[model samples]
Target: MSNKTPTLSVTIRTGRGKGAARRARNEGLVPAVVYGHGTDPQHLLLPKLELNTILRNYGLNAVIDLDIEGTSQLVLARQVDVHPLRDYVEHIDFLVIRRGEKVVVDIPVLVEGTPMGGTLTVQEASSVEVEAEAMHIPESIIVDVENAEAGTLVTAGDLNIPSGVTLVTNPEYAIVAVNEAKSAAATEDEIEGDAEGDATEAADE
Candidate 1:
């Protein structure tokens, strides 16, 4: 909701190979790569402690104000390679970014509220792909199904794009839909229970 952008600072590590990464990890640094915008992929190292702290607060999209050996660059998170077995930053990829540059990214959609006593089904026809300015990407889109009736459906074309955001997903794509909850049919056990209740009431008369 806030317009403030998040940033982190890191350093350049020219070392390569498993041993080099292990040493960097031991020294509290993360192995990373900087690529995109037709530039050569630069292998770098980031401060593990500082990056972890920022990610813990800002999530995956945390921007970096990388100070690689005192040269500063603005970048947006692109990919994060992790160790499947442990809590370590195996590698990271950052996309070089400049103001007013449009970048495509997928944003999650959250649906709130349910049709009364009915099953609210999520039929996500498409994930939100938008081309937004590098510095102005939105976090998540909020969709309200609050008290929406059965048979009602919401589609991408129906979505209201936030200011400065452009939709890349197909307009005809379905986002979600509401339907009637399934009703339970009378079973043998239910019939027996009703008979028992009737018999008990009759006997009490």
Candidate 2:
């Protein structure tokens, strides 16, 4: 978790429509809306390059200080829409937040070290949900598998989350498990069988 909050400069969006959105993008802006705290939604335009840079550095769970015109508001990124082919941000939804408020968020799970005895590690969940102070959200939760043996199971409850964070995910949900590694001969045989099956299907077609 980082204590730093990236700041973004934004302006009130005056127009609404695909054409307006297209024009905003053409001018290197991203269309976004901010809503929460019993307030009306505010449509705004953000600098595309600056927003991308912030996301790249802080991930999706980033807390940002939105400097709209001259007033500042603290917010959390609730949703983001991206261009599938071009991979650029198309739109964003931000949630207004206050200091010291606890927010529920999904933090990425990271595996550390390797399992022992030539076992293969299977990750069942890539992220876990937790409730924490909106200003103190963790970047990721790490699961240590150092010297773990086959048949070892790591569950969400086994994770060591930072203090002030409460687990919101089911405690028994499996995060990672170690299984016996497949032999090279077995892998080769499986591949051969798959190839034969594909050929037979092709012949039928």
Candidate 3:
């Protein structure tokens, strides 16, 4: 994760219910709640545009320093609710977090390098869950295939995760595999069969 934690200034919302939420949206604000650590959930209003930009730049699990009316609180963007047909963020749920606290997050898995000739690499899982300090969450985990032979399988446990991060995903889970590439002759035969089927359909018509 990037070391830069952007700060957002938000205000506590006193109004409740759908009417108040709708009014907030009309005013270019997003209704949100912050709750964690055995505290009461705080209702707040955040700038819609600013929050969207932050999420786009920092990702869904982005951590932020929330300036709630004057008090500063570190939080994680735990959940986001988007309008189904409008495609805009409607509400957000923030989780209050501490620097050293461990949080479970899904990190992207990237496969690097090419497999041996006549073989192709297939990624079985795109992301894996990991538990890491709130301040030290990694951007992603990489698994190198590098000239691997056919039938080679890479599992979650084989990943070279960064120090201080623990994999929450099952160690036996397959992440990627190298498989034999289909032969050109086999593809051609399938194409010929499709053409023959088309010709028979035309005759029937």
Candidate 4:
């Protein structure tokens, strides 16, 4: 949950095309691009292990400082492309940001406390969009369901956001809801009964 920006070492990349990208991967480097802020896109190469470690520790919304041959740039991870089956980072798209700048990002929604009255709490949205300072983004928005009764609904408007953050999601959008828990055994029995009745009708026909 730390807002501290991580600094990564990157190098300018000159090669292009699929063969070049494959060669970079074979050498344990990830191809990435830095863009935005009225600047031309810069193709770069990053260490595979270091990039993965930062992403794993800080999550996708992490704002990081890239040290490119001694020059530093503050950027946010906008999009990440990963290898389909190998779970490795293939490419990343970064957006440049400045201090005090507000950016829209999707923040994870966390549920706290269980609903009352033997009800089951179901999450409708796992994340919500918000606008916050690029360097001060909140880790996640928490939804407190303590003592919530069956049929209780929590909407985007009900979320408690930190000061200086603005909710971009629709206020009426449902985030979570409480409903009575259904008996799994009973449901299984009903399905079995329906199947037997269908079989009997087919035999009679």
TM-score of each: 0.77, 0.90, 0.81, 0.88
Candidate 3 positional error at 29, Å: 2.1
Worst ten-residue run, lDDT, model 3?
53-62
Model 2: residue 19 alpha-carbon error in angstroms: 1.7
Which ranking of candidates, highest TM-score first? 2, 4, 3, 1
The per-model lDDT (C-alpha) reads 0.78, 0.96, 0.92, 0.93
Ranking by lDDT: 2, 4, 3, 1
lDDT of 3 by residue, 69-104 (tens): 999999997888999999999999999999889999
lDDT of 1: 0.78
How does residue 68 of candidate 3 score in lDDT? 95
Residue pairs that clash (backbone atoms under 3 angstroms), model 2: none
Tens digits of lDDT, candidate 2, 114-141: 8896799999999999999999999999
lDDT of 4 by residue, 78-186 (tens): 9999889998999999999998899999999999997887789999999999999999888888999998998999999999989999999999999999988768897
Q: RMSD, model 3, all Cα superposed?
A: 3.8
Off by over 4 Å in 4: 1-3, 189-205
- The model with the greatest lDDT is 2
In candidate 2, stretches whose alpha carbon ends up further than 4 angstroms from where it belongs are 189-205
Candidates 1 and 3 compared by lDDT, better number: 3
**Candidate 4: residue pairs that collide:** none
